[model samples]
Target: MLFDAGTWSLITDVLAAVFILAGAFLTFAAGIGALRFPSLLARMHAVTKPQVLGLILLLIGLSLRVRSWSAVAMLALVVAFQLLTAPVGAHLVSRAGFRTGKVDESELQPNQMEPDDDEHTA
Candidate 1:
């Protein structure tokens, strides 16, 4: 049996709300982490991770509300693009920060870096 307009509207509204709330929460958490993190790399992690997820959630919510194949396909494309770009963007940011000496070595543990090999080189 097909759902009536009223029921379909209610269901769509509820799903949309859920997706929006989840996306908002993810974005808020990312913002908090970016603010609170001690290092640039850490902040990059927070922003990249949650931003992608949040966008995906928001897109999914929008797709559900629209209830059309084209909308869903567009949302899927958006999700795919984000997934492909977010990590590469984060890596580029982190690498740039590292190269520019923007990141504090003191914030990272000594063991995290490779050991000196002067003896082996000699």
Candidate 2:
């Protein structure tokens, strides 16, 4: 069997473990950041950014170990959906938080009481 029980060899197993552990560590750090960040926007950024990369790493590790096309396809879909939705979710959360006065407005620009009036100013 190519994978015997789970891994093809010690190297692959070790690599998978490394990737998974690193991903888990990043996720843990995100969790900590969510708790330690000063405000809602900071917390949303902490939860969304690293967590997406962490999820990618985790799915990669799982794909390496699982070695099945169907599983890989599903994981791919999960990654795709996450990439698509994470930013939207973060935006919604931060917008709602800002509207609810949970955001740190002092950190914003002097004229940023609302978003820039010029939509093309990016």
Candidate 3:
């Protein structure tokens, strides 16, 4: 009743195209940042943040284009797995770098990872 079927279809197609292009741009930027950033933490940040968002956006566009519940469900699962793993993987890598002395303590603010000196006194 609101919009004709043809107009609605056109609108969805336009939106899908916009989402896909934006997602692709963000994914490309993430790759560039991962390669260009000077520090491990910076690279991890680049890989995790924009990469996840780009994947989510790309999947949304795909779901819109496919218009199938099974495909959307599978895409949602992929997004869920990505969201769940990226941070955990980043944390593990950063922790390993910190423990192995690959990470510079000077770059860390506050440096809470260091054991407090007072704990041994008690």
Among these predicted structures, which one has the highest TM-score?
3
Judging by TM-score, tell me the better candidate of 1 and 3. 3
CA shift of 35, model 2, Å? 0.7
Residue-by-residue lDDT tens digits, candidate 1, 55-76: 8888888888888998899889
Query: Please, what are the lDDT tens digits per residue for candidate 2 over residues 31-58?
Result: 9999999878789989998999999999
Candidate 3 displacement at residue 45 in angstroms? 0.6
> Which candidate comes out best when scored by lDDT?
3
TM-score rank order = 3, 2, 1
Q: TM-scores, in order shown?
A: 0.79, 0.81, 0.88
lDDT of 1: 0.90
lDDT of 3 by residue, 17-84 (tens): 99999899999999999999988889989988998899999999988889899999999999999999
Ranking by lDDT: 3, 1, 2
Per-model lDDT: 0.90, 0.87, 0.91
Residue 121's lDDT in candidate 3: 81
Better of 1 and 3 by lDDT: 3
